[model samples]
Target: MNHWDKFLAPYKQAVEELKIKLKGMRGQFELDSSHSPIEFVTGRVKPIASILDKASQKGIALDQLEEMQDIAGLRMMCQFVDDIHTVVNLLRNRNDFEIVEERDYISHKKTSGYRSYHVVIRYPVQTIHGEKKILAEIQIRTLAMNFWATIEHSLNYKYKGMFPADIHMRLKRAAEAAFRLDEEMSLIRGEIQEAQAFFTRKKELKQEEKN
Candidate 1:
């Protein structure tokens, strides 16, 4: 237990720090009264059980756990598919960490019809002894894509990756439907942002009245 804690401490710290920095990007956009490519950010360090399971499945030795790119994961949800690319570019421009690799699951989806842009980064965390470099994965996707992927992930756990034929077909159909939804929303992105801005100003005025 103590060994596990020590092993995961740097990963946990990396997740927390990255979450704050990513969320801060959205905050900056909000302050500028501009549309943020990032809608929300979420992160986690993989649980010990999940880490062990994945390591076993991948034939990774215990000492080679650092080879696992997603031991610490962060997700940036966007309102539209275009915003996903925008967020990815933003990540590319940041100097806080080095992006080691990228997987364009959105362009070439998985066999299970998953869609997302994954960025693997090598982040350095300052520990008491020295700086520790850890690999973390950042996933960027539109809200519609995220919704479908979340459902698919849950089903994967339920079926243990062996889905019934009917369910598999339905999930593939659902993935297409979600992508269509994202496309439709992108067409009206301007109108949506305008409406959001109007509502935000109205809320600010009401707050001022209360003050």
Candidate 2:
């Protein structure tokens, strides 16, 4: 295996296992017919090119890439702003992973108006050789926040962190709109949850009839 592949193998394993575990939590809530704070879980190991770029940008030595905390990243998307907090609490209560640090960007947003709850964690993965501890980052955000952040990320790539005045202003405005959308959704979260539960029950009844 290439050096990058060999180095990233443990992180990849960590992401896969964590994705299953986190998704299982949602499954449990579904089986109980309860509202799950987690909408979906997605994960990825950083691409070698991106990792190199980040390391260079941060003046991190390539040999010391282990210091790159987010090389293995997982994102937990939520339906409402409050759901973000729920997911964060769930992570805090978990024993399989040790949360090393937390960055609450939602309350104190970035200058670019990025908003997400970042939790850095150290997780152990059992390998053929031995147990390896891998650092991973879990980013919890509402769907609206994720949408905005995705767009902003793409724009950052295009602009290379040098956005024009107009584009910068528009991005800021869009971020505000996204945040407002989350707030509006939260206001009707109870009704939304009830509607979802109703549909789930209807679907279950249909399945029973088929059986």
Candidate 3:
């Protein structure tokens, strides 16, 4: 248990630091009274059991666990599909970490009907020993896409990957529906942003009046 904790310490640190940094980007946009491409950020270090299962499934030796990019994962949710590209560009411009790879799952969705943009990065973490570089995966998706994926993930857990035929077909349909919703929302992006900005201003005014 101690060994496992020591091994994952850096990964946990990396997830925490990256979440704060990414959320700070959203804060900067808010400070400027501009729309932030990032709606929210969430992160996690894969559980030991899940990590072991994935390693075994992929024939990745324990010594080569670092090769598994998603052991430390972060999810950045955007309001619109276009915002995903904007966030990806921002990530590319940052010097804090090196992006090792990118997978455009939104354009080339998985066979199982998953859609998201995956960015694998090598992040440097400082420890008592020294600085260690670790692989982490960031998934960018729209709110609608996330909603569909979340349900699919839960179903995957229940079915253990071999979903019933009907369930599988329904999931595929749901994925497409989610994508269409994103497209429709994108068409009205300007209106949505304007309304949200107005709501925010109203809330700020109410708070100021209380103070």
Candidate 4:
């Protein structure tokens, strides 16, 4: 009954382990800001791998299937670009995981208006029975970038790969705005964090005085 269920177990295992890592990795994106608190939204997109075999059964190639891999994705939408880079660097420094590939789509966006920092890494997860290397893709981007990307993707899927001219222009404009916004936000974040630390110290001092 289960023809290729074996490959599925490892894929599912890999995805589950990745979800756990992403949960723990959430804290890495949060930072105190003097004006406003910064928080990142983490999301995962997982496509059914069984679709691959189904595609093959329908006389489709793996390459074509990859283009159709619009699902099975994860997005870490950050408040600032620095946090995006911070998360990327944090992953790079880790010894427990190895980076298989890195694509800076932020700098080099796709022609279809896609923008995000994508990294493919293999992290070894130790289970009760044994250890396994799970390959997963991590996308780091600012909230603005996510906003633009989401809209464009939705339209693309809706139109079935045919986007109108106005839609394309809007996406480009949004991408530009997102870039500028991320920079401006980064500068403000640094200033606010400094102020927060000062306030925190002041509160600590007052508590000490009462004690």
Candidate 5:
């Protein structure tokens, strides 16, 4: 195995285990025929090249890159604005991890108009040698906000974070629209959650009958 491969093995394991645990939360909500705050979960271990780039950009020494909380990242996408808070609370109550920090970009947004709730956690991973503590970042956001951020991230990549003036202006406007959409969705959240819960019960009934 290469040096990078060996170094990232534990991080990869952390991502996989966390994905299963987080997704299991969604499963529990479904089984209970309740509304799940999380719409979906996704995770990744930052690639070597991206890690190196981030370290260089942030003036982080290579040895200290291990301190980067987002090296192992997981995102929980929610269906409503309030659901973001619900998910964050769930994370806080979990005994498996220790939440060390929280960054409320949703309330105090970014200059680039990004919004998300970020939590830095220390999670224990069982390795052959022993249990190891690893830092991971959990980002929770409404789907609308995620959509805007994904597009902006792609454009930022294309423009190398220095977009032309007009493009930047348009992107900011789009971000506002995305936030508005989230607000509208939140307004009707009760009706939507009821409909989803009803459908879940009906599906479960059908499964019981089939069995």
Candidate 6:
């Protein structure tokens, strides 16, 4: 079996259940949006294991990772950067999830220039017979971060992270620009939402006038 199948095959339902639980967790923070569904990203382990295999060949022991499933990795996409903080705070309150680590990658972007909020939470879940501890990694990011990550990922694949120097520079520039744009766009979103609400009120008033 492949690396992921080896780890996830036995825990398929558990994985999905965790996804549901995670969505509820986000909802508790009031950051839950209609568009956010806990994504199932299990197949990503293949490349990860390959990286680990490379480390092993270099004389590093990484066997434990291969069998690890509760490595509870999740990405929670939010509407704004502020929502990221909101979600993090909500996770912190619960006794069920013991916070193991917290990383504000949004403030301290990755070396590759990625940005997001990461929280490692350990929550106890009930099973058919007893309760079990499940480790879940929650990554909260704005839609802009998600867009940037998706585009950068495609470019990383298309050019294998080794594009022409000029192209790489442009990508970096775009990512930075996207960061600033995210804030501006978020403000515009609020304005637009307010405008829509106003329009709806006017429409309701006009209908009432006709009646």
Reference-based TM-score of each model: 0.98, 0.98, 0.98, 0.68, 0.95, 0.67
Q: Candidate 2, which segments miss by more than 4 Å at Cα?
A: none
* lDDT for each residue of candidate 3 in 75-135, tens digit (9 for 90 to 100): 9999999999999999999999999999999989999889999999999999989999999
Q: Estimate the lDDT of model 1.
A: 0.95
List clashing residue pairs in candidate 1: none
- lDDT string for model 2 (1-211, tens) is 4977889999999999999999999999988878999999999999988998999999999888998999999999999999998889989999998999999999999999899999999999999999999899999999899999999999999989999999999999999999999999889988999999999899989999999
Indicate whether candidate 2 or candidate 4 has the larger lDDT.
Answer: 2
Q: List the residue pairs that clash in candidate 3.
A: none
Which portions of model 6 show Cα errors greater than 4 Å?
Answer: 2-6, 9-14, 25-62, 66-71, 125-134, 158-160, 193-211
Clash count, predicted structure 2: 0
Worst 10 residues of 6 by lDDT: 36-45
Give candidate 4's whole-model lDDT. 0.66
Pairs in clash, predicted candidate 4: 34-192, 45-72, 45-73, 46-72, 47-72
Candidate rank order under lDDT: 3, 1, 2, 5, 4, 6
- Report the lDDT of model 4 for residue 5: 52
Superior by TM-score: candidate 1 or candidate 4: 1
Model 5, span 91-138: residue lDDT tens: 999999999999999999999999999999999989999998889999
Cα distance off (Å), candidate 3, residue 163: 1.1
lDDT of 6 at 193: 56
